[model samples]
Target: MTISLSKDEERDFDREIRPLAADPRCQRMKRFIQHGRITTYEHSMNVAREAFRLNREWHAGADERRLITAAFLHDYFLYDWHTHGDRLHGYHHPRIAAENAGRDFRVSARTQKIIRSHMWPLTLFHVPTSREAWLVTLADKICSARETLFERGSGAGHR
Candidate 1:
């Protein structure tokens, strides 16, 4: 989890990550628990950071801005799905998130598509079509598995 970032890379990350991370609507994600103790905001950040790193490390020629933006907004469904909203959260949230992203962020069609496909086979028909989408999907599963299994310590309380 501790990837060494060069100064240039750090700057690039900040440049790409800061605005969306700082958005008040995005900030609202801190109110919802995602994994055991992790906030959706934190989870989204993990996914975005990991996907960005993977894009560079794997030399996956994804557009950095689109990749980073889509990754952060992939889970932008803006609800506490565990307690409320649709029971089939897994199957529907990607579409909701993508819609929210489109309305609020005016993301490109490709970026919206990436956000929509992050859930992959669980979503079945909404398969990821681009390297960027696949990278976000992979990073999301990796971060979620780690958080769901390991971050559920007794001390980590829901806000």
Candidate 2:
């Protein structure tokens, strides 16, 4: 069964989500929301929502605030990976996002580490240690893959 958040829970999400989504970097991300490419905003929201679902399933005691924040900002680097004309995104985007997040927001050390290590065992060369980080990593891959498939016009067959 799917768990649904209560009205108050959704209110809490709006409080935090609105501010972050309004941030300048995220505003830039919004422009790509309909660029015929999978957007950062869409990817970030999907990851957060999926991670929240997974957290609920595991009965994990992770802080919801941190999990949402990390997932939403995980792809804050805001570049089109395809247009980069290189595969450097697999190696570079996380660090770029972490640095920008550090500068633009008052993020926790844990959150920063989550962002920096989200590409783990690939770009990071190590697996994440925190429960939230692991959740975000898994959610990122799941959401990104789905979005990629959707963008490729193979959504019906793939799903």
Candidate 3:
């Protein structure tokens, strides 16, 4: 089931994400599918929402802005990985997304690291080192698994 934010939560989330959402580059994610029929934009928003919920539930005291930003931009690599799947997209996307976030958003070193490390043991060396990084990493895994497993079309032809 899809999650819905409360009225107050929606206000807070919109405030936090509005600046990024206004950018055409970020908006372009609507055209790229991340899993099943879910667009990258939708997946990123879900990851951000889940990360925020996890942080609150665990009382993790992570920086909210940093956590949300990193979560939403974690897959900001800007290309359709499917048509151009080189087998390295899984291993390389974190780095590419981090670079794009840094360049486009001027994110902090901490935020960039959080984005870079979201792929975790899959990337081996790029382990999450901060509260926010770990939150985004776990949230990414949760959202990706949900989309890849429970989404429509019989789980056919997805990354």
Candidate 1 — which pairs collide? Answer: none
Decreasing lDDT order of the candidates: 1, 3, 2
Candidate 2, 1-159: lDDT as tens digits: 112566776676667678888777677876554234556776677777778777877888778889989989888886676676657777888888877778788788889889888988787464688999999999888777677656632132433
lDDT tens digits, residues 1-159, model 1? Answer: 334567887899889999999999899999988977788988898898889889888899998999999999999999898887677999999999999999998998999999999999899899999999999999999889878867753355544
Q: What is the TM-score of each candidate against the true structure?
A: 0.91, 0.81, 0.91
What lDDT, from 0 to 1, does candidate 3 have?
Answer: 0.88
What shift in Å separates residue 145 of candidate 3 from its native position after superposition?
1.2
Model 2 residue pairs with clashes: none
Candidate 3 lDDT by residue in tens digits, 58-111: 999999899999999999999999987678999999999999999999999899
RMSD of each: 3.0, 4.0, 3.7
Q: Which parts of model 3 have CA positions greater than 4 angstroms off?
A: 152-159
Number of the candidate with higher lDDT, 2 or 3: 3
* lDDT, residue 35, candidate 2: 30
- Residue 131 in model 3: shift from native, Å? 0.7
Model 2 compared with the native: what TM-score? 0.81
